[model samples]
Target: MEDGTKFRNIADLDIADYLDKDQFARVLNNATSIELESGQTLFEQGMPARAFFLLLEGSVKLTRLSPDGNEKVIDLIHPGQTFAEAVIFNGGPGFPVNAVVLSPSHLVSIDAAAYLDVLYDSPKACLDIMARISQRLHWLVNEVDRLTLHNATYRLVSYLLDQTAGASDESCDVCLSAPKHVIASRLSIKPETLSRTLKRLSDSGLVEIQKDHVVLKEIGALKKLIQLETDHFPCTDKKNTLAVEIH
Candidate 1:
């Protein structure tokens, strides 16, 4: 059987969450499974994005090139996440970034033209999908706010807290999804800066590093640290006077 004709379990696809039963079956009928190796290019920056993907295993990084030819890591994708979905609806240029596989990865590529065909059959589904995508857009907007408005330590704290996976205990064990340098890139910080931040965090009793794993000694303290950063921003002061806001 060809790659596109191979039978795949619907349960393995995270993109299925965005559609109803009938729509999922329709889309699945046109899906294809692809396995890629580490250091492989799933799609380049300008390649025609005819489909979106659901990663079942391993990791991928979305990146863009600057005018000076430096690559900036946009986001690191882990398993159970759908990527390139925006391109299907973008209706403009090709994919906005290059999606490179960081490890051996298994993914399901959904044919965008087929997906749109399904949507055309049901007008309500189109609104539902767009609403869901728009809802998810808040995260991207907040990411922009984080990158441009916050300091390096705030971003690192937010990243660490995100890796905790909702551990309610006073302490939590976290494993990094990628190397220090890749992670630094994803966080938009220099590798040396990440190292220094980690050391400072370690010395401050906020966390302890063990090779690729980091143990958050005080998750509460880390949360407070983020809040502290928020509280201390000079532009966001809220006093006993008129309205104050940070742009």
Candidate 2:
């Protein structure tokens, strides 16, 4: 268990991006921290959502389980990201997906009632959350567009290019943030299909796959192969394109 002071500090950190000293301190007083092991579930689909979580370390996979017992990965959460907030605010009976740790992880969990109280009392905090939700929706839209594109190679290469944001273009190495199976689920592609697409790209001298890492041999060739605008393929701002490359 974390000491009260440390718990409060983590709580303070969660809302620090949108709250001031007084408000952060108040929110901190009502928050707690929880640890999860790899493969442990934080929440399940159709379960009442009573709280929201801010991931402080490690990664969490958001997945939806179908009636036939199939699981489809929806997204991966990294540090500095909040999950289940929309469900909490929407007063929904259950979350739309299941959340499970991909690795040993630490999270700050805020009770829905407490968070809602703060949101009602703090207009700025509400605005901040609304803006964040809007941005996330925009990202989801782009992801849908990418998936709808008929070309599998385009989807695979576009996903790779997206991950290169903020990386040194000089280096060929690119780390994949998620396992191949999880990535395939998120992309709505089969693992075998993804593997074949990657192999084809490699054969064309476009990229190299080394274990969990990918090395872009010729980015220009990749952009052309994917039919994406060359100027927009790698993105001008590096950080925004980091996850796009390997997702």
Name the best candidate (by TM-score). 1
What's the CA error at residue 116 for candidate 2, in Å? 1.6
lDDT of 1: 0.80
Across 1-247, the per-residue lDDT of candidate 1 in tens digits comes to 1333233454555466657787888887788878999999999987888999888788999999999998889999988888888778778679999999988998888899998999888777788788878877988899888877776778887898988786984999888878889888888889887887788788778899999899999998888767766676344444311111211
* Residue-wise C-alpha lDDT for candidate 2, range 1-247, written one tens digit per residue: 3465434445445457887677665665677788899999999988998888888888899999888999999988877778888888777779999999988898988788876887889898899989988988999898888787444566777778877776544446777767888888888888887888788777666788899899998876665655643234655565333223433
For candidate 1, what is the total of clashing residue pairs? 0
> Cα lDDT for residue 164, model 2?
76
In candidate 2, how many clashes are counted? 11
Each prediction's RMSD to truth: 5.5, 6.3
Residue 108's lDDT within candidate 1 is 80
User: By summed lDDT, which 10 consecutive residues of candidate 1 come out lowest?
Assistant: 238-247
Error of 1 at 231 (Å): 1.6
TM-score of 1: 0.86
The runs of at least 3 residues in candidate 1 whose Cα sits more than 4 Å from the true structure, single-residue gaps closed, are 1-14, 233-247
